[model samples]
Target chain A: MADAPAAERAATGRAAAAPSRPRRLGRRILGGAGRVAAALPAALVLLFLAAPMAVLAISSLNATASLAFPPSSLSLRWYAEVLGSQEWAVSLRLSGLLVLLVVATTAALGTLAAYAVARGDFPGRRAVAGFALSPLMVPEIIIALSLLYYFQGLGLVNTIAGLWLAHSVVALPFVVRTVMVSAQNLDPTLERAAASLGAGRLRVFWTVTLPLLRPGILAGAVFAAVTSLGEVAVTALVSGANTTTVPVRIFSAVQFELDPSVAAISTLLMLASVLVMVVVDRFTHLSEAL
Target chain B: MTSPDPLRPAPAPAAGPAAHVVIEELAAGYEGTRVLDVPELTIRRGEFLSILGPSGCGKTTLLNALAGFVRPSRGRISVDGADVTDVPPHRRGLGLVFQNYALFPHLTVAGNVAYGLKVRRVERAERRERVAEALRLVGLEGYADRRPRQLSGGQQQRVAVARALATRPAVLLLDEPLSNLDAKLRREMRVELRELQQRLGITMVFVTHDQEEALSLSDRIAVLNGGRVEQLDTPERVYRAPASRFVAEFVGAANILDGVADGGGVLRIGDTVLRTGLPGPERGRPAVLALRPERVRLHTAAAEPASADAGSGGAASGVLGYRAFVGDAWHSEVHLAGGATLSARTHAEPPPLGSEVTARWSAEDVIDLTTAPAEEAR
Candidate 1:
């Protein structure tokens, strides 16, 4: 009986010292369950966003003549056809030119407008800021319809300039919002300090304020470029026969034929967007820019 | 005084000496609300002047007005006899150090220091030399390649000072430059800044809310209150012989005792009468006395009567209510017989709480002000 009590006491001592075993096991199980629950939604979102691009890429390489899932054979015939087409090449060049113009114009106008809104304190400053940012609130179709009517009145329809103008209007708000946030986060004292150190007003702005706003400018420019590259609605409304951008071309192609050529073009557009995003992420922190 | 002779070559432009900065009747406001009203202030060359005041006291406004950041409504600001009131901040030939250091974060320390010279269109070689010299003066010789964020707070402030000094402006304005530093670093930087100012022999105006900082660093301190200069004098004179009750109380903690002058070179506090150095008024006139805590001595009941001839001594004693163990001293609050409280700071450890102690101060140590009362002084 003495040995039995001693053995029970020893067991109790072991249990007391190792009390965290059950708690740790419970915590591990709960943590694993939580991880699974969190990952399931993320996995579902990723598949939802990525499945279309995956299917497009796969269809572009199929040897068959029609759209098919799990192709029996893979081939690059559609890519070769896409690369060899004069219309596709012209549309690609047009889109590139539009992207360049839109990105440059939007970045410049957005940075200037953001500076005025964030730093300047003139009368009706708030109202002016609201008007400048109103593009984001309006529906793109309304913007396209208005631009269509306005350009038609101006006799600028079917020209690249009209398309560029419409795209710039749509892309300007993104640049303005991004750069404005960046300008707002900057320290105003730095400019004042530069001025106090014998720097003229222009020099102070250029040397101090502009350098700090570079990240915002880069972020806004990249977003504007990507958006302008893939813009369809406004481009379709204003673009003439000779000024059809890639998205307009793709839209026309889809109406006539649902083939591997469209998938190839889409895959190329997606690749370009991912490339721009990666470059933007490398140069400036996207989170901070947002 | 004789009028100057008009034909004597304009008296050689009064070649005796010149005040580096002369501010006359300066008045400034923000958005139509008056903030600063300094009647006259002249800062001589090579002097360190401190503008000491609490928040909203207009010290910073005064500095800003002098720096041309705030245009005075009615005043003349002259730097080295040249009127700069209408000039812009960049043209005032003055350097300003902000409270946050304001170092440009995107630029390296060398770039920040070289910015002023570049703006002035100085020769590239001379600019490089001056930048290096300025960095060396601040003891940041090798930190030229580092950005402001990579440096510590003190190092950043030094870079700011270096950047400001690179242009050799006529005056330097430091607005709470050391307020962002820790307490120990603040003390060390105060010494370093004072030494630098003395070595450079440039007129400097330092603004601070800390009395210790102002007293320790300034050649002359302007104590401001309610948008007016309360008193401007040396630290010793300001402390020992404050012109008003506000100056006395603001510069250091004072024990304000209200009394009535009783026509006999004596002041009456309740039923006890004490001799005063201030001239006695007609009977029943109100007066306020400022007593420093260090001047008030605490003694046991047995020893109180012996010091009666020096000042008023009461047989009644009160309990030592609170005791704090300050290093090298003991600060105790004692409740007196008349329900009034007085603090005593002694070199020796005070008696424990609840012990009876008598508080005594000499008549000469109490400063008398003709102000309304202590509550109205501030």
Candidate 2:
């Protein structure tokens, strides 16, 4: 390990001192081969990730109402149609409002739960943490089926309030996991030092604990917003005719008519997800949030 | 066997320095095993006392209890004659500086120092003045705008101290605040901290496992062993006349010799006899003797010139093992009879290796530790 750098320096010096034509060509070829070898897997992964999005974007631009790629002519007619239709507009507005409510509820509830589970030493602390993260492990189909029966029993079917609650429950685990990471990183001694400096419990929480956990809370809010915006399974089960989200509308549209407007709306949702990610990364490194 | 007399001191007179904090029958533990049990301990006003002990000896636990961070299961803690055992840490009106220098990273240096004053509802004008005063006290005047991460370790330590002092509490508790700094910085900060404590005349309770730090900085050192105070005395007495075997070995290097007391101020080891000057523990009981290396004087056997001076005190004859210069003094190891070894530190040159020499010490310097209970291995 210690001599590898020295060996590399010696090799570089040899190359620099003797830059003959044939040797230089051979070295260039070797370097290009090594670079290609290193980048092949990464390029494949990127291609795999972007293939579906590319097809969706391309099909959304078809002039007619057909979800066909490589259309006879490229035009923004479907984008206009999706934006102008009242049914699609209603779903967009409903999804937007639901995203806002889910972000607010999950951010508040997740941060509180994270602090308690990570820092508190009560009897069932581990169990509470496990329960908070259990949604991430259980299948979304199960959650959707359960919420269907549960909300029906509560007379919450077809209500926007029910969809809001459903989205929050689905998005809460991501927020909790991110905020828990930040809470565990928090220095307990800082709180102790604050208390020793004569700050009461409430004062310490407001002044020290809350400010230190801001990055995690913001990251959690972003996660909640993105998760709620993309959620479909739970929303499908609980949402009614008055509260059909864009994803639900697109799901039904692709099932029967195969509308190009569904492709347009799906492309827009993907764009919104990317935009939220960029903004969140600019504020707090998204890698740290997970 | 009887306990040493000087290890325990009488209660202070009414005219002595007033007691600032009193701990009575205090016993604190975690998970049902008591780690600290102080029957009676008092911190006088404006005195620097160090709770000195090795790790796991409950010194930090004692400091936490005093700072109101750890509640004693049995007994009371009183400050200024008011019972505060049940008081929360924030309401205890005491300052504790953590070893890590737990300055809030989000706050600037000035903001960190002003935290206490702000919590007390001090007005903006006065709060600024106190923050400035504290920064100036720790020689951090121009560092008000810099965040804590920008400061060096020494500077951060000063900020922690300044933050603790800004509140003007009744006492300041420092938990090895200088242990994290480099060696030279630690020494410099030690002197600066002593000067600061003396200048302010505020009572300070310093907790440290470093014996040199405790010796140099404390007015009185409380030597703890196995969750008990073995000896609490001036640094000089604790070093010169350790109260127990644990104190002698822990405080400094000591040549502990096992011998049988003859009850006439004499002890016999192997086939050699020495005058201890201290009262013997029992007539025929085995006794442990503690003698500091610095006190043991090495005399060349050929000289034979110390008859009058060395006749009344402890004496032993041994072959010189080796001698090495240790910057300030020459340290020599003497191999005695019966496979025992003795160490001596002296300024003069020691005899050559394998040469016979007589190690002598004054009778008054001998410490007898036979009565101390056998310390459990922690």
Candidate 3:
């Protein structure tokens, strides 16, 4: 690193000392080339991520009733149809309720667990944190399969409560991770000051600790909401016909045939997540939680 | 082992153990490390007692124990003659000011000050009165509506003090409250805290690592080392005659020299014999003498006699190694014969480096720490 800086300094000095116009032009061209070389991979990554969303959007606008790239003609018919369809609307509503339930459940549970993991000292603390965060580490397919069997044995496989539990379990780790980051950063002295100022334990947590955790709570809620909305495999296995979520419905619909309305629904789900994120970002800086 | 009966009736606080806050046989630790074990500490009502020590010396733990923040393994703490060892922090009714001055960021200055009153369920009118009175005590009356983050660091600490005082607790505990402020602010807050404690007539226990702060503001100082109080005395006494080696070295710039006590009114350090009024060890017993740096005077001497009476006691021949003038005083590092170095401070212009000089000190200033046990210092 030391030699590289010295070499760069020498090169710059030589370039400055050179009186030739051609040499200066050559160095400028080389600098531009190096800049492009470094940015090329990032540009390609952006394109790869955006291309599918663009394809999904354009295909949703297809005038014909088929899923094809570079749609032949543009039309809003699929959007209207998707919005009007009963199954689509029902699935959307079910997903919305489930997402709301998961966000609320995970945020509360995550904030409590994060407080324990970050601040409390107890026997088997590591074991408890690991158990709480197991879903994030283990394979999702295994979690889905195990939960499916468990729910089936309880005869709640098609129930909204069972689906809520599964989605909440899956999203719990994300919420805990975000909230834990904020919890660890919360100075213990603040709590001490509160206690010394005659605030009881419950009052301190409610008035002092909870208010400071607002950013973490909002960030965790956003993560859990988005994750629950887009969840597929677990929701597919646990959700019954009566409790069919949007992702579960989309998974089953793709098996029989391709519906352009699926694309429209996907766009709508993405838009809902974006709207949730925007609202949360208005209250707290999202990057602070991470 | 304790030293032979203190030579000068070692100066201490006028008030004895009859105190408003009393800690007895307190022992506390965390995760197997013993942090504090105070047999007894007594704080008189309306007295400013500073617990001065280096970091991890359990000064903070002692303050926390008194505040009911740290549970003792075995002890009893009584404030206002009421035992409160098992009491919780809020019920203990001892106010604590944190090092960070953790004023609630969400609350305005008035709201922060009124928190303790609100938690106690004081009526609206009384709460407002107490909050305003507290702010006025800290000279922050106009800043009632301002947020904590909007105030300067000095202002924030004043607010913290105001918040702690609003509860009207018997004893207020301050844990390094001025540590986060700049030097000037720290000095300013020191005066403010002392004045506040006096004006309110509320006892204050301050924990600090800064000895100057302790010396200037405290009526009595408890010098702690390795979770134990080495000495509890007036600041002037502690500075003039530290009870042990730790206090002598930790409190101020001290030049400790190896010596052997004679059977007379003198102790011998290398080739030099110094006069002493202290009742030191027996003849030829190993002894350590600590002399304050400012007490040592540097003189450019040539052809000095081997042994002669200098100013106060005697002088030792040495070469000034490095000399520089600080804004307040002239400082010079002198190299002696036995590969030991001694620092001297003089108000006069310092002699040049490598010049032969004699370091002289008064016999009265020689601290005899030979019998004072050396506590483990972190």
Point to the candidate with the largest TM-score: 1
Instruction: Encode model 3's per-residue lDDT on A1-290: one tens digit a residue.
Output: 33644575686775343336875587779889999999999999999999998788778888888888778788889899989999988888888888889999999999999889888989988888888888999888899999999998998798889989999999999888888888888998888889988888999999999888888888888888888988998888887779888888877777887968788888887777778777778777886775
* Every candidate's TM-score, chain A alone: 0.90, 0.88, 0.91
lDDT of 3 by residue, B1-378 (tens): 043544344334334555788889999999898999888888888889999999999998898888888999998998888899999988888888888899998889999999999999999999999999999999999999999999999999999999999999888999999999999989988888888888888889999999999999997899998899899987877888888898998998898877887866556777656555456678988888788889887777764434445434645667899888898998889887666678898998877788988877676777777777864535
Show where candidate 1 strays beyond 4 Å.
A1-20, B1-18, B262-282, B305-317, B371-378
Global lDDT scores for all candidate models: 0.83, 0.87, 0.85
| DockQ-based CAPRI category assigned to the predicted complex of candidate 3 | medium
Cα lDDT tens digits for candidate 2, A91-204: 999999999899989989999999999999899999999999888999998999999999999999899999988888889998898889899999999999999999999999
Evaluate residue A68 in candidate 2 and report its C-alpha lDDT on the 0 to 100 scale: 59
* Residue pairs clashing, model 1: none
**Ranking, DockQ, top scorer first:** 2, 1, 3
Per-candidate DockQ values are 0.70, 0.76, 0.70
Stretches of candidate 2 off by over 4 Å are A1-35, A62-74, B1-17, B262-266, B270-283, B302-306, B310-312, B322-324, B349-353, B371-378
Error of model 3, residue A277, in angstroms:
0.8
**What is the descending lDDT order?**
2, 3, 1
Interface RMSD of each: 0.9, 0.6, 0.9
Write down the lDDT that model 3 would get.
0.85
